[model samples]
Target: MPILSYLVGKTRKLGLGATRSTTYYEPAHIAREFATLDHLSKGRAAWNIVTSMNDSEGRLFGKDKHLEHDLRYDRADEFVEVALKLWNSWDKDALKLDRESGVLADPGLIRSVQHQGEWFKVEGPLNIPRTPQGRPVLIQAGSSGRGRRFGARWAEAIFTIHPHLVAMRAFRDDVRTQVEQQGRDADSCKVLTAVMPFIGGSEAEARAKRDRHNALARPELGLVTLASQLNVDLSPFALSATLAEVAESPLIHAAAAEKLLMQGPETTLEQLGRIFASSVRVPQLVGTGAQVADQLAELFEQGGCDGFVISPAYLPGSFTEFVESVIPHLQRKGLFRTAYEGSTLREHLGLADLPG
Candidate 1:
């Protein structure tokens, strides 16, 4: 966060991925860290709300097992409420730094949070001053029903993974509907899809790059990863065994674990293994700059997403290629920014600015 502070005025936003873990650190600590970062960045910090998925994470935190998915999110909802009360503890006009007055701040303007809930018991105003944005932006990336409800109530933005346009559009609409049902403006929460793009000068070049990358992918590593995510070892079963043979795991993200079953009864564990091995879970665009731009524009125009979190299939090289090629095409269509117009992340994302 301190490192990101230096880039505050240079158009950078710090996104801290905070998993729910009251056993390791209290919610108050999470609130203070992000609050401090938000202050230092002058309102450019965001919290990527998450529930740690793996048993490995639980072990590292001194837990015998990870909490059930629904229970974890249950805790998250209360945790966020406490953090918000703390953030809003100080009124907007609480700060009174005046040379003429004998006081540095007005004590009466600040109030105790006094948050007592199922998961946390936080009291009083946070020691740090209020952030420039009043509160750091809340970001969420959970695709499950329970996760979506939590995001609707608290997240200012949501990150999602959808393999098709229809599903993506439906997901966006559903989330917005949920937001309205929660008595918040439907447009207040922005939905961003994670798209892995492999852009090249031409279509053939892109395919070749993807093929090369795939050939080097290790299926065993993918199984290991899937096991960690599902909290069930895939090694015990044969590659040809169907998902129905596996008993439901106690401590897994139920929605994510059920995804393999949704694929169909004929899909072998081997096929699913390859899918994860090659990172084919999220939708991928492998094409020329113009082709990639057209797809992105189509998705954006059709209300499929507010924006896309483009994850390059390969680091630096893929990123450099896209910036030099695809971004220019997007800029030409007026679908992307040609130059940044704001010093803060929220403003860049078309969010309202705080009053001075």
Candidate 2:
């Protein structure tokens, strides 16, 4: 959050997002922190809501065990409810900086939140005034059933990982239906698919760069990560054994296992592990700038996603290359903005203004 706050000072148009776990953090604290960030950034702040995964994260927060998956989402739903109440506590005209009258604010305009929910109880109005954007943009990244439900209710933008176009379109369509069921506009929530691009001057050069990057992946490390994500023990299986062989593991997450099997029942556990470690299963685009742009355009036009979340392979260089190379192609195709269209993040995303 501090890093994002610092970035707010350094940049003018970029949306500064920071993740906060609903399972671990207090609702009031999150409300105050993000409110401050929104104020500092002139409404460019965004909050990526997360219910932290893994038992290890629970241990760090002084819990004996992590809450069950669905239970975590339940808690998160209430947590966000409380945060929204606090954010909306103050009226738009609450603050009145009249020097001559000496009235800093209108006392009656600021109402107490007085929220008491299943996971949290926050009382009274927030100390800070109403934020410029009303609240920071809500972003979520869960793809499971419960996760999708929670996101449909709260998230203005959803970050997802689906390596194939069909899966991406299915997920987006499902979410849009759910959002409409909740009585919200289907277009209100934007779905963004994750992609890691290996851009070069030519397609062959890009493929070679990607292969070199993939060669450096350690299969053992990949196994460990894959085990964690699947919540199953990989130690019992031989590296050469195919995922189809272990599909019957009672401990394995069914959806995750099924997705892995989709790659190929004959694909070795080691190969799957290596793929996970290399890109965490995010789709990899290996091509020149124009070629990469074409892939993204196809996905966008096919109802697969509203946009993309570019997951870079490396740090500064990966992002720098995309900005310098890929962005120009996207701009030429009228798929990306050539310049800032608005100052606030909401405006940038074309989100409707919150009712005052």
Show where candidate 2 strays beyond 4 Å: 249-265
Per-residue lDDT, model 2, residue 109, is 91
Over the full model, what C-alpha lDDT does candidate 2 score relative to the true structure?
0.90
Clashes of each: 0, 0
As for model 2, its CA RMSD to the true structure in angstroms is 1.7
User: Per-residue CA lDDT of candidate 2, range 1-356, in tens?
Assistant: 98998898799899999999999999889999999999999999999999988777789889988888899999999999888888998999999999999999999998877877777777868999999999999999988899999999999999999988999999999999999999999989999899999999999999999999999998888988877765567888888988788786675668667866877989998898899889989999989988998999999999999989999998879999998988998899998999998999999998999997
lDDT of 1 by residue, 1-356 (tens): 55555566564543433333433567788789888878777767887888778777888888888887899889888887888778878777788888887677789988877777777878879887788888877888877789899899988889898888999999999999999999988888999997888777789998898888777777667778778776776777678776655434443346545765776657777777777787757788889999999989999999999999877777768778888888999999999888778766677678776543
For all predicted structures, in order, the TM-scores are: 0.91, 0.95
Q: Indicate the worst ten consecutive residues by lDDT in candidate 1.
A: 14-23
